[model samples]
Target: MSQTIDNRQFRLARRPKGLPERDDFDLVTEPLAEAKDGEVRVAIDYISLDPAMRGWMNAGKSYIKPVGIGEVMRAGAAGTVIDSKHPDFAAGDKVSGNLGVQTHAVFPGDELRKVDTSLADLPVYLGALGMPGMTAYFGTLDVGQLAEGDVVLVSAASGAVGALVGQIAKKKGASRVVGIAGGPEKCRYVVDELGFDGVIDYKNEEINDAVRRECPDGIDLYFDNVGGEILDAALANLRLHARVAICGAISQYNVTGNVGDTGYAPRNYLSLLINRARMEGFIVFDFADRYPEAAREMAAWLSAGELKHREDIVEGFDTFPDTLLKLFTGENFGKLVLAVER
Candidate 1:
């Protein structure tokens, strides 16, 4: 006789029209089944909460398919393998992948990647060493084409990706790096804690005026995480031939209405033409083949104490709905991660 295990999951109940509410999800418990051949079973420990998750819940065409109603909500998670019927993985191995929002998950072994937990904690893989880290790496270096002595500006500077973007710019020899964040505490953390050259408190300062004052030499590179007014401000102060990397637009993720109607589309886009600059959007998945290259370098930086990372972990799997709202409310100070209460 084998021991029985139960799986707890949050299934999508509706396509949210605005910010997602608890009612949009159906929390259900079901008995876990044994893994089939070529499959592995994992007990999820940490789940990533990103603004992109909001976009993934909507009904539409996107870089990835939307989570169908009644399906387990899509998520990136890290966990330890508890059972494996595959040759590549075994019990006790740590792994990370699109494990969905569940206490337990079973997937084809090929869909999961084993992570070196000796180098980083399981939750760190969901932050600085995970998707956010990769996004910052390629978005800044490849798409933004960061160059030495360039003055860089990044919005949502205290966020998971934006924080790394600013630090990477500085470490790569940017002359100066300025950040824009919502509150004084976040602004201070961006500059005092993260070593940004300067920071603008978007809550207190006029975004346009602050951007002009901070990047007096004009911005050579703008790493945009939160779009809308911040992006427009960055555009208005671009240096000659500057590059703008459109990463994730957290500011616009939850807006309702037609594509162009609800969110604030840039009013200063003409600045791109005037400055002879380039603005391009990139998905980190596009650089999937080169992830090892980025991971190795980031790991080295972390070990060398040259890179700083933070994770705002919330305990309890049942708190998923309210916990996710923290990202939109600017309450999460760093990378938002949900840790399953053991």
Candidate 2:
């Protein structure tokens, strides 16, 4: 705290119509603030780039409030504490929170969760040990209500949330776990690396046909990350009493106008009625009180090598606008993380 630091941040300049452009944000450098009583100042190390970020840029009623124009862009970030005025946190402690798109930030100590670097890397906290992990955990087990011997299908299978959903399903005794991902490389990773029973390369194959082929007996649980046609494809193959966990709709996140007007809605939804399936959408924060429970199990899986996670690390805080597009473009192989340059 002795030396003055300039904190650079991306503030929302305007609401983006479709995909966010660099102009949508104004990068400003300002003097960093000192931590007040019970507050901590952190030097950000990594920022999470997620599909949900696109939705947050819009102005409307949603799970979370939209980032106001002129406000720092909202983002989940992990960092090392530069200074702390809280009893529990000390300087050099690693932490993660909704720290926004900035090089440094200050927040109440209760708002930041201290992380252990010994168990995992700092970036890993923004991936498997963070919101994405919590989304996959509760989305599969709680919302999807996965059952043993069920045939599970996961859309965006190689993503931060989808990848973990497939693996968690398999570990919980699912008879088969199938993933839907774009491109051959992602398909291979979902199967060869993540241990999914099979994967459909959405880029090469028709999603509906591929879903039917991979899940011939129909899917008992579908954990959907990329909605639209992929969601329709999963819906068409639902088994009796199937459960669908709608974790995200990345395919529709960039719609220019009203989502229902411009986005792709399912055409095969009738299958849900025929199969008596349940489709539910969930926000990870809904299960916030139980985060420690999920973290313990996820950590155990990581320690035992039962779960595998990958982080697509992009260097430089300036790359955030372009980096986030990777999620919609299917360029990121795993969890997309932005490493803030010193």
Candidate 3:
């Protein structure tokens, strides 16, 4: 008898009102389909959980089209190709891409990139070696236009990308690197473990006051991850011609009310004018052609102990909804990923 395989997926059942709820997603299982010509069957090992996933759930236009109701929730994942009919792929090859929230998927081989397990663990590829790494790399160096001896400040300091931004800033010869993260524990980790020059416990300290003290010399570059009050604080401390990389605005992700009504818009626009600063937003996909070059340099940093990486991996495909909720709550530390195979 031939073997029978099952495919499980977390599909968007409805648009989320705020933080995604259980009913927003539907878990469904079906028999795995065979790989057809020009297609490959991937046995997903892990799924990435990112703050931007929230934006993808909204009803309207954005950088990427919103996940329509009933579609498999969009995600970047890593897995092994179990069956292949395309020239570029073969069975047993490990690959990563927008694999969605599923345990098994049959896709055009062109949609995947082969990953070497010897280079990094599969989950790490979904974190430091994946989109997060690419985001940090270009956002800091290219978008922010960093300079040696510059004072750098990055929000969401202990997170997957933010953690790397601070470290990369320091490596690139920033005179001071200050990280703004929630709570004392994350702050300590940012400074002590990640080698940030200083850290602000944003949950406890007055954000504006913290930024003022931490960047008394003025912020030369600000790699912002959590916009809102944090961006306001960073704005107030900018030096002349300072550059700000708008990496993400996770602080506003779960707002159930009108996104405009949140009243979190920067009140310090005058600072930008006064300081002649520049602020630019970027998407990692914009730099996809150069990912291999960035990955090589980052891999060298990782191997040399100059760059630090972290992840918060949770098991169980059935727990997808609850696990995704953890990103908004900050319940999962580091780069959040799902161990889909379990």
Candidate 4:
């Protein structure tokens, strides 16, 4: 028998000012249509709420188009297939794709990847074994060009991607791994739990001073997640021929004004020239072709107990708007996933 399910979604009520508010999203329920040829309908289990979503909301030039007014907010999601018309996928198959923020999504079968459930949990596909993990893998290896015995420093050390960056650097034979995170608890987790060589509590200490103390020899590779002042500080402590991977900049996402002047600027531009360092920004989507390769490696590490992942799962689909705010505030402990289904 054919069944109809209620599809609840969070729409952009309006563009945000500073931090996005509840009013910015309008919760609406609709009826989903049946799948056509080459399509698959997903009952989304977990929706990934990332800092990158903030940039997607703004009407500006970016890697992808901004979420238009009254459109469903863009996001990455993992779920199970209830219906399929595509040749590659079948009913009851588990898949992960960018399904936006909704209880159900009908997308082209070619857009989705069938996941192996036995290897890891479903939410891990949205996190450690997913986009965040891939971001850390490619950003550090290709962009940062990390070499053996190089000193690697990561900012936003306890978040999804940052946590993986530190761990991967360690596995690749980094001589020293330093992490900068907000609050004492996260700092402790990065060092004690994640096996980072040192940690800097950014909330309590001056970032520049902390970097100087933790990295006496300067940083060979800097995996920047939280930019702004910390980015500037990292620039001041770059070693000769240092590589800086600009993965994210959550610190300046909510700001309404100009970033170049109002925000913290690196006073060490001269040092970049003198040290012959290179700074490059990359989006994970740029390495989409190599996702399978990266996923294989990350999964092997997870299975071997060499890689660790954490998830901060918030219950209920209705809490999507509120839960997303947690990432900006650092309220989430790990990869933040919104559980839409019971």
Model 4: per-residue Cα lDDT over 1-342, one tens digit each: 478878898999888877899999999999988999999999999999999998888876778888999999999999999999999999899999999999999989999999988988999999998999999999999999989999999998999999999999999989999999989899989999999999999999988899999999999999998888899899999999999999888888887622222255567767779899999989999999999899999999998888988999999999988899999998999999999865
Predicted candidate 3 versus true structure: per-residue lDDT over 1-342, tens digit per residue: 327788998899988887889999998998888888999999999999998888888887578888889999999999998889899999899999998999999888887889878868889889888999999999999999999999999998899999999988888999999998888889889988999999999889998898989999899999988889899989999999999999888878777523324447888978889999998889999999999999999988877777888888898888889999888777777999999754
Alpha-carbon RMSD of each model: 1.3, 1.1, 1.5, 1.5
Clashing residue pairs in candidate 4 are: none
N/CA/C clash count, model 3: 0
Q: What range of 10 consecutive residues in model 1 has the weakest lDDT sum?
A: 254-263
Q: For residues 18-57, write the lDDT of model 1, one tens digit per residue.
A: 7889999999999888899999999999999998888888
The alpha-carbon deviation from the true structure for residue 107 of candidate 3, after best TM-score superposition, in angstroms, is 1.7
RMSD in angstroms between candidate 3 and the native structure over all alpha carbons: 1.5
lDDT of each: 0.91, 0.91, 0.89, 0.91
Tens digit per residue, CA lDDT, model 2, 86-147? 98899999999999999999899999999989999999899899999999999999998888
Q: What is the alpha-carbon RMSD of candidate 4 to the true structure?
A: 1.5
TM-score (all chains, Cα) for each model: 0.97, 0.98, 0.96, 0.97
State the lDDT at 139 in candidate 3.
Answer: 95
Q: Which stretches of candidate 1 lie over 4 Å from their true place?
A: 257-262
Better of 2 and 4 by TM-score: 2
Residue 79's lDDT within candidate 1 is 96
- The lDDT, on a scale of 0 to 1, for candidate 1 is 0.91
